[model samples]
Target: MLRSGAGHPDAGQSEASTSRQLSPEEEAQRLYATLNEYLLLEHKAQPRLCLPNESENGEVTTGARDGAAHVLRCLKVWFDLPADVLINAISLFDRFLTKMKVRPCHVPCITVSCMNIALEQYAADTDTKRSISVEELVSISQSACTAGDVIRMSRVIVDKLSLVTGCRTSTVLDWLRLLRAMLRLHADQCAIVLPPSCQEEELVQLLEIVCCDAACVNTRTSELALVLLYYKLEQQLAESLAAAEESGTIPEHAYYLYDFARQLQLHCHMCDTTLAHARARVRHVLSRYERCEARRDQRQRLVWRLSERTLKVLRPTDRLTSLLPTIEEQHFAVDATPTRTRSGSESSENEETSDWPRSPVLPVYCDN
Candidate 1:
């Protein structure tokens, strides 16, 4: 967790009065350094989009990333895991992909393993409920990975990144906490009411939704949280003022709009122009997501079936089938899509990996 007023101390009445004597510039500078302490978790490390091996479809990649994230969200809701688990899981997933090469077929496995790792870390730190076992996770996610695969992948990820690194990096939640405090302090200074209508859970849910956007993968969490709050508060303020006008009554937070942004920018070191662009991007992404959601809702009412040709090739239970090789399926098969090494030679899975049940006479994996 990002400690508030980190590396700083509280003061008594006399000391507090002395602090009040500082100039505005000095105060802002002091607060800025304190706020920036939240970003101590490798701020230089940014996670970017990782394309699947030999795949060119950007839509598929986006869909895959979003789809995987949605799986984590569902798991969180299903298991009643803390919000930290979901955010940390997504961080692990993004960072792991950014740090290594992963095949498209392995995406589901990788995603689940990341979630499991996060869940374990969270549970260990908080001493909460035990994580879902590897077998159950594979079954629930329908990720097609074997229990062994999840274990191996989890080990690989942990070996690559430290356990705390996922949560150590500032997340949307951390930024939201900081911005909320700043907003509250500014509202008090203006002698205006704070947000009366916005609930904490609502704000949390909105930020979580915003984090789901592909654009946010590498975007700064602080800016995303700031803009999200800015838009929400601005909307609430407008609504309150309009209602107050119609009702001939003063609304709570009526005067809170005065110098609303000064402290946020000064304390958080934000650029107005950059924030504006990020807010626009987030707005566009949400609009697009809502439209997609509406379409999905409509489609849910209708029965859509695969084409006869597709059904002929795909079994009804194909989605539920495990992708892991069984004893009979473990013989070395020629890579249908061979990858090239830097030496410019074709490399295939046939180039010895883990010990497998071998059959010398025939290919275990039938492409057909």
Candidate 2:
């Protein structure tokens, strides 16, 4: 979340400080060059995941990814981790899933392990001790895996992907920060006052939400950032128009902002139609994630359907039947016959004769 405008002007700063370090032409050329460099880096670093179609495994893989994204988002917020860490974690998790075939049952363990890796990598850069231990992470995530399991999974991820987790990966937020700075520089060089740019915090949060979409794993970082940026711009414009009409006056900087958006498209070499489609897709997924989050918050209890194998592990004798009285015990209260001898050999013929039906009854007892 570091500002991309290190040497450039910051928001709310006077134009005097902005200076004339780069002319309009120079600024445009620089933006284009920077876009090219990011394009290459994004190609090399963006995560890839192929989500199964609806016909596959009841969409278990897709659900796992989307679920992991949301959980990681919450975990990031809880840990107060930087916005980029969530992206890095999710990217690593999805990439690992893409590299191998993972069962749905193991997805939670893998998700938590990926979060641990992301934290370790990010913690190194921050030079602080990790507040959450491996055991704590497992417990907090409600993962069935133990600390050792998470640790082992982390090693497996490192080995399978061969990715160096020592440094931060280029994420969508990085692209957005750079793009926003490019826009600001463009405005400064053109001497055209545009509306106050979108807030970085809001943009970062929105980008994080957008990443919850499983489809986003396939999206290039540059394009995803551009879509979010453009969506925010459009949203701002609409609000401005609404306020302007109410005030009976056209908003200042409207035309300038519109032109600036066009320049951004051109600088990024994105076709207008393609950009619009992407914006629509990003908005749709954002809304979907929001709705789901709302429902999640309103949930009164944990409601999940565990598979049969998991049920067995959790409920020995179904965890309920073992406590209940059998029909004979409930009705007759007869002393139970011992099924095992002192020698530990079976003493009840019925117990060893499971291969035969016992309910046909004796010929004398039945109406023949």
Candidate 3:
């Protein structure tokens, strides 16, 4: 992460140094305006339809395999996105299709309905009638879905998620982050550190449930940042704990999970790449711990305080400080192997002015 107020010639300083001198405030205003413009452009460029080549089957059809293929086509047309997001979407679609057996022609309607359900859950308390505008969905696909069908499908999607995970977007995000975090902490421990062999698999199943919930609709909550960050931290701490036990590189401390989570939040941005890296680390740790803790039922029992009932939300900036170790203090710097990079436009100038917002920092902890 690059610092905003650093001494690297003040960024765009070169343009000003050799030419007409604009005041600092004027420069600042220009920067803000430029940033706003870039943001708008990126928003416009955000993926609405999946890549065309992947779903180029000529015309929609029926029957078992064909129905599956047709649904995939509808998915391709409706906000075709990356694998993670798509996996979630498909889960919702499958759930509804299995129960409702929506016709091939109605694919568009169901797609819209699913998206609206997600919008409602995520946006909450808003007039969802205008929530997922049809224009945006239609504009993206050559074979667009009807407005009526979209509305219909949303109802079913919502019902399914409500049943599967109590219809709470926050819970889903919490579970996903926790699983990702635990996997990051250590996969080996999943078999050994956690109380039972089923612990890790159970969490993964929860994530699948969430993904299925989000799929038909986009229902992730505002607290997603905090949820993700918490997962990342828990995972790293788990990994560090196990690694220390083996190599003696770091000392093992009881209930050190809180401190580790805090440290990651302080030093790292909660970007997807950072989260993914954290997840990978946890996966490695779990795989290793499983071999040694194969017989121990309670070896890796680090408590994570994620429930809203137990934890208090802190001011976004104070998230890092809020998670400092309560008992013994051990400090360490994380050498993260770069796992995330901007999607496109690698020019130095373009990279410098890219409009994406840095991931917001949020922290939460159990109320002791």
Candidate 4:
């Protein structure tokens, strides 16, 4: 929710000073270089492994991962932690798990420990106090891991990962921040508010899905983030175009969004050769997204059909009767002339009425 020049007291002044130091183009170039360096470092730090090797005995399994992911998601919702923190924690956990063998029994302790480390790192970055308590972390775990257990695990994780306490590694979040800054900078150039900040939560949600897939385990974080952003922007653009077509008018900011999407696509294609394995993983993520959407749509359609049938059944039969004319009423109205005969002729009149004007009765038979 924090904007570049909002919330913080000196944000505007700092941004102004920073802008004075470099042009937008130069700033973008610098960010690109920094992100590229981070990507290289990430690749060097952990190379991709084959899937069979990754799923060896003592390694984490799909079921364990799903359980851990569910716990993390619950913690995020319960504690109101930033998406960035949860993502960082997951990243760190996965990296550590890749190096060390972890049993299902040890997952909860390890998960909470990684989250604690991520919280510390994030707090250090933003110069904010740690908000979560040991009790809260322990309560979120599936197993009864005490604060002492979490502390010991944290230490082991830090030492094994060689993680510096105050410093955080460059992650997908960093890439997202850079992308937002770039879009904001360009939007300023065009005198528009084309910030992609609104999509941050969506991007994080997509990343969560991608992270769970086994194919994405070995994919580079930056590539995953970029591909996610690429698909997200494409979806947005498609929706915008449909709306514009209906309205017969397009917003000026639409062009800027489209341009940014194109840039994202170009970045993906340009980096395709270097991150060749990532393309398959990205495709897998997209397939998962599509399947999720399809299922959601299918569920909605089923509900709609059920509701429609219920409405039909609940409709007033009297109203339908009033709308439709019956055969007896039609025959009486058509052939019932005034009878001035005596009461003795009433029986014969009734007998004649039965055979009189059978044409109206034909409609009842046709209706049946």
Candidate 5:
């Protein structure tokens, strides 16, 4: 739970005061830093969309690069992972192929496997509950993906990242952390779909490649992230559409496409569960901040009231002599009997005074 002012006195006072004191120049600098960080993440997460170089390489060679890039882009769109992540996955595939020497016919298999690995890692790390299982991974890899091809690619990616670097770099880790934060802000449910254990390494690899690429590093805004998301989903939809067409049951593929597309579309209205959850979490924190402010104000008012009452009660002690007359006045009434009558009655009054019942008696103290 978020702390209130009573719990974090300094945090409550200083932040509120500083927010008011911020100079225009200081505010501008803060905004610039935020926008700059967003742009860098955007650039790295999305891959270059150009067609593969065809002048020197044959159709098979060119086709392989194209297929891998397309698949990487597709996953980015479908899952809304950062562009850097997709780039990292593709680079992983490229590096693996570069070292092992695979043929063009193997392109689709490699591409699908790379995506599976990336998604697996994302889902596991973010969610405490709900993740894709090994059985599901195998099923997706064998059926929707090309005949168990991604299984080998998954192993290759894990081993290569482990053997090549031994550990992930600080830069990659930082980017992943930031991207996760951003996704949390937007509420990305890739955690449910991919899981942390399966995609952790792949996500790291994706971030590394994205950092290395100039186009990604130099990006100006989150446009890269957005475009990457759009293309990634489109690619998946196209592939599913093609497969359904091949099976002569395009309706089944349409159903798959519809489900995925529905998610992406829902995000447009800020309706997706992941994005909504992210928004709600932010609102929850802000609401706590507001509630703290309200409580502090109430406490201050109560304390001020108590202090005033204490002063009103104690202030008379300093002027006790001045207040004495008012106390006496409260106890007695003015003498209303005529002086002549009092004189005449005085002689007889000794007897009458003793017999008369005293009018309501007013007690008095002599002047102190």
Candidate 6:
């Protein structure tokens, strides 16, 4: 169980205020130190959590990990959780699964339980509404587990990991926030103002991609964020250069953006000496994104075709047969197609018929 005060609602707010009081250099140093500590702890935990070389139950398969990632993505979209919550939940889920043996039947419940724990810890300060309830989670997962099952699994996780619920993880979002603050405070030094384009939605999407990629698992969160920011800066610089070439004149702001990109490159080199690998990872991420975008239409068509073909072949007793209606059917049936009238002469009759009750009902008076 999470200890009292471990996830106090005000802790992040208070920490942010304290960070704001510090100089940019001091803040950077503090964040680097904190990140280092987290890296060290994670290194120590990794050995204990790794799957055995030869286990009776078998090793954790790639398919399982991919499935988990898929579930995390779906949950994030369905609940509209912030990047922090989703990242933290993924962290917890990965850590727990690495340490324990979970069967396919149990993965959905475990995934939901991790999200439930993360929501309890991190969602309090966000403007988003309360996280989805266990019932909703179960429905979303299409799992056999009831609400009580999820609660119980959560308890087991808490006890097994000795997890301090709400204890902050050094997630990519934390690193991004620190980087943003540092850049904002040292704007004079960087000689650039971060455009709104560089900050919110795009960065969130990048973080989501990085978090799900297996290649990035060993990378430090701060380093990963640094690499991502560097890529964005590089992109901005490239655009500026292209504009400058086309216009035959470089804008003053373009110089600042170039300087910022150079600074980012230097910082990234300092943070990770293996620039080749980091660049490769970034390229891989970009390629993956391109592929996904290119395949979007094709994949949608494939899914629709598969759904139709598979539905036709499914037997009444098939497990998926029960899921079809629950998964895709709407709760309420309504005919959305517009009703056509023969002419103006029939308008009055149509109105009269529409006013009639569709079903008989007993009326009762209620006190106001």
lDDT of 2: 0.70
In model 2, pairs of residues that clash are none
What does candidate 3's lDDT look like per residue over 1-368, in tens digits? 11232112233555576787766566545444433333233222111221122233542222332343344445434654323233334444544554553445667666555544444443432223433465565555433656665666566666654433213221223324333333334323323243232244444433333333212122222123233344444665676778788987774442344444444444333455655554454444445545656868747688765644333443334223323345776565587554666666477676644643344334556799
Worst 10 residues of 5 by lDDT: 1-10
TM-score of each: 0.66, 0.67, 0.29, 0.63, 0.30, 0.65
Top model by lDDT, which number?
A: 2
Instruction: Give residue 37's error in model 1 in angstroms.
Output: 1.4
Which digits, one per residue and each the tens of the lDDT, describe model 1 over residues 117-209?
A: 877866665557775777888887888789999999899998886554323455666567656655665665667666764556777787778
Q: Candidate 4 on 40-116: residue-level lDDT in tens?
A: 55553342433243455666676576567667767877898887688778777777877786676788899899888
Weakest lDDT window of 10 consecutive positions for candidate 4: 356-365
- Tens digits of per-residue lDDT for model 5, 1-368: 11122111123335657668644455334433443443333333233333234534433354456545655665566545655346555655655554555656666666676666655544443333434443454453343453345676677766754522212221234333333333332323332232232244544443333333323332322322322333334455576678787888654432432354344344333335544443344334345546866888567444333353465475533222322223333334477643443465457748534543332322356999
Top candidate, metric TM-score: 2
Candidate 4, residue 165: how far the Cα is off, in Å: 2.1
In order of lDDT, best first, we have 2, 1, 4, 6, 5, 3
lDDT of model 5 at position 312: 45
The lDDT per prediction is 0.67, 0.70, 0.42, 0.65, 0.44, 0.64
Between candidates 2 and 3, the lDDT winner? 2
Locate the minimum summed-lDDT window of 10 residues in model 2.
3-12
Alpha-carbon RMSD, each predicted model: 18.0, 11.2, 31.4, 15.6, 29.9, 14.6
Off by over 4 Å in 2: 1-34, 53-60, 165-168, 189-197, 246-252, 289-368
lDDT of 5: 0.44
Which candidate, 1 or 5, has the higher TM-score?
1
